[model samples]
Target: MVIRTKFMFRAGVTVLALSFSAPALTHPHVFAEARLDVNTDSNGNVASLHHVWRFDDLFSSTVLVEFDKNQDLALDQSELEEVGNVVHASLADFNYFQLVTHDGKDVPMQAPERLIADFVDNQLIILFESAPDSPLPLSGKVEFGVYDPTFYTAIDFVEDSYMTVNNLPAGCSSSVVRPDPDEALAQNQQSLTDAFFNDPTGNDMSKIFATRLELTCSKDS
Candidate 1:
C-alpha cells in the first residue's frame, strides 16, 4: 500500500513523471518516515512487529482532501476508517511490504492484524502490527526491513534511535543500515522496468535501497 500511496501521491505532483524514465525517477516521488517496534516473546523469539508509517505533507494533503467526503476540511472517524481499510486491502498484495530474515533465510510474516490511520498536521500516519507466520528465534542473525520491491515508495527510518527492539534476549543487540545500489545497477535501471511493478514477486531491487535492521545474539556453547 505504501508503494501505491507513493505513486498516487507523486502522480498528483505531475502526471508525466509516471513515464519511468531513468532521469525522471532518479529520486523517489514519495517519502515515508517509518519506525519498527520489534517485540520478542519470553523464549527470545520474535513475536510481532509494530509499525508506524508517516507520509509526507504533499501526499497527505491530497489524501485528506480526497477522503474528507463531507468537505469538513478534516478526516472524521469514518473517513479515517476508510483510509485504514483501503491501505490494509492494498498492502495485502505486498505482504504489507515487511521483510524479515534470519541467517540468510526468509522469515515469513502474516498480514497486519490491525491498521489505524490518522491525519495529523497535514500528514497521514498509519499504525499497524505484523507477526511472523511462525515464531522466529532471536538467536543467530535476525533482520527486518520494509520496502516496496518495485521501488515505488521509499521507506526510511525516521530516526536511528526510534527504530527499537523490545524484550530482546540479554545478549542480543540490534543495528540499522541503508544500503545503496552499486554503480552498474544505479546506471542501468532499464532492466528493472515496469514489468516487476505489474508483478512484484519477481523484483527485489528495492531491497538494495531498503533500511535493514540486524540483530545479533549470543550463541550457547
Candidate 2:
C-alpha cells in the first residue's frame, strides 16, 4: 500500500469530481496531498496498515478514509472495532483487499495476516495480505471524510517507510528490477511522488475536496 501524508495523488480513479460544497473538482485540478492506498497479500490477505493526513488539504476535514470491504477478499467474518483514536478494520474491510472473482466465485480468504502501510508524497496506502500470487483480483471501496479540515492545524506524519514501519528495510532499489535495486526503489518512490504532487506547466489548483471511490466490474470487460 502507498500513502500520501500531505495530500492525495489521485483525482481520477478514486473520486472524479468534487462537491460544490468543496468545488475543487468543478475544474478537476490535481490534488497532490492527503490520500492512502491499501493492497492485499499474495494470498489475498491484508499485510499492512498505513494512515496519513496532509495538513495542507484542509477544509476542516476531520479525516480521509476508505470503508466498505463489500467484497469476498477472505474476510475473517468479524466486525470492526475502534478504541479511541485507534481504529481496527476487520481483515476483509480494508481498502484494496476487497476480493474480486472472475465469475463471482468464492475463493480462499483465510484472514488478515499482515498490513503494509505507507505515506509518500501526497498519498497513503495500506495493504493487508498473507501470501503472494493468490490470483485475487483487486477491488474495494474507500471513504474520505472532510468535516472541518479547513481550519485544523497541519499534522506531521511524514517519514521514510523504513523509519516509520520499523522494519529492517528490504532495501529494494526500485519497483523495477533490472540492474540497481536501491536506485530503482528510490526512483520509483520519487517518480510516483512527483507525478502526484507536481502539476503540469499550465495547471494550477485552487481548493481540495473529498469524495467516494467506486471500483467495480466493467460490465463487459
Candidate 3:
C-alpha cells in the first residue's frame, strides 16, 4: 500500500525532492532514530517486536505542519492516529523495514498493529508492534535486523540500552550487534554510488550495515 497520509506520504517517498533534482537517487533522504524491543512469552517463545521510530527534525517539521490540521500548531491524538494508519499501511510492502531469522532460517512477519503516532519537540515519534508469521521459539538462535532495504530511509538504533529482551525464560540473553562494513565499503562510503544501493532485486547492500539483534537460549532453559 502507498503512503496515504498527507504528511507521511510526502515524507516517506519524497524526502529527496527537496535538494536533489533526480528522484531516482537511492541513498537515504530521511533518517530515523530507532529503538527495538523483543518481547517473549514465559516459556521463552517469541511474542512480538515493539518498535519506536523518531523521525529527524527536518522531516518532522514537515509532518507537523501537514498533519496539524487544527491550525493550532499542535497535533492532537486524532491527527496522530491518521498518520499512524498511513504509516502502517505504507510499510507493509517494505516488511516494515525489518528482517527476522530463527535457527538460521528466515522468519516472515505479518503486518504490524497497535500503531500510535505523536509529534514532539519538532520530531515525529511512531510506535508499533510486529508479529512473526509463526510462533518462534527462542532456541539455538534468533536474529533480526532493522533497515530500509531500498536505502531510501536511514534507520539507526540510537541507544544500546533500549534494545532489550523482555519476559523471557531464565538463561536467555540478548545483545545488539552493531554493523561494521568492510574496508572496501567503508573507504568508498559516499563514492559507492547508487549501483551499490540499488544492488540486485534479490539482494541489498543496506543489509550489510543493518544493526542485528540476537537472542540465545541456553539448552537447559
Candidate 4:
C-alpha cells in the first residue's frame, strides 16, 4: 500500500519528478537555503529562534502551480498565506526540521504561532519563529542546525552570514561550523549502513552533514 500525506501528495510529487533528471544516487529531492537568528533574553538565556528558509526554483514553481488558485501566474497575499499555512502544518510531523542541543541533550521547541510565506523572484521564502520549551541558559555549549532526517530536503546554511545572534550577552560568542562531508561519511560508516539507507527518516543521519551554529558563553558573564 502506498501512503501519501497531504504534504507528500502536494510537494513530494515535484521533488520526485525532479529527481529523475539527477544522478540516481542523489538523495535530496528539494533544496533550500536557511537563515537563523538566535534571540537571547535579559538573563542571557535563549528566548527564541527566528528562521527564514528559501526554497529552490523548481520546488517554488511547483508550489506556485498548486496554490495559485486563480491562475494569475502570480501569488497574491491571500495565496501566500495559504502556502505558509500548508507548509507550517506539514512541518509539524518533522518537528519543523529543527535541531537544537545543549550539552549533548536535545532541546524541545514549541511550535510557532505563524509562518509567513512570500514568493520572490520565482522562489518560495518562509519565515517563522520557534521557542524552546524552557529558557536555555547560555553558560554551556549550545548547537543549532536544521536538516530533513528523511534526506528529502537539503537545507543549507550556505554562508557564515546566514546565522545571527540577537540581544546576546557581553561574554557570549557564536560561530558557524560546517562539517567536512567526506570526513563525516567516513566516521559514520557503520551507522550509515543499509538499514539507514532503507529508512533514512527513521534516524538522524543527516545531522552528520548539517552545518551548525555553535554558541558559547563565558562563565564570568
Each candidate: RMSD:
5.7, 16.4, 5.6, 5.0
Write model 4 residue lDDT over 1-221, tens digit each, in one string: 00012333554442212111222234776788899999888888889999999988988888888778789999999989887877777677667888899987889899989899999899989999999999789877889988777666788888898988887788878899898989998998988877666666556776878789998878765
Model 1: lDDT equals 0.74
Candidate 1 regions exceeding 4 Å error are 5-27, 183-201
Q: Give the runs in model 2 whose Cα sits over 4 Å from its true position.
A: 1-97, 130-221
Q: After superposition, how far is residue 130 of candidate 4 from its true place, in Å?
A: 0.6
Off by over 4 Å in 4: 1-26
Query: How does each model score on lDDT?
Result: 0.74, 0.27, 0.71, 0.78
Residue 9, candidate 3: Cα error in Å is: 11
Q: Could you tell me the lDDT of residue 205 within candidate 4?
A: 72
TM-score of each: 0.81, 0.22, 0.78, 0.85
Ranking by lDDT: 4, 1, 3, 2
Error of 4 at 18 (Å): 15
Candidate number with the higher lDDT (1 or 2): 1
Report how far residue 95 has shifted in candidate 4, in Å: 1.3
Candidate 2, residue 26: lDDT: 26
Error of 4 at 61 (Å): 1.1
Worst 10 residues of 2 by lDDT: 200-209
lDDT of 2 at 193: 41
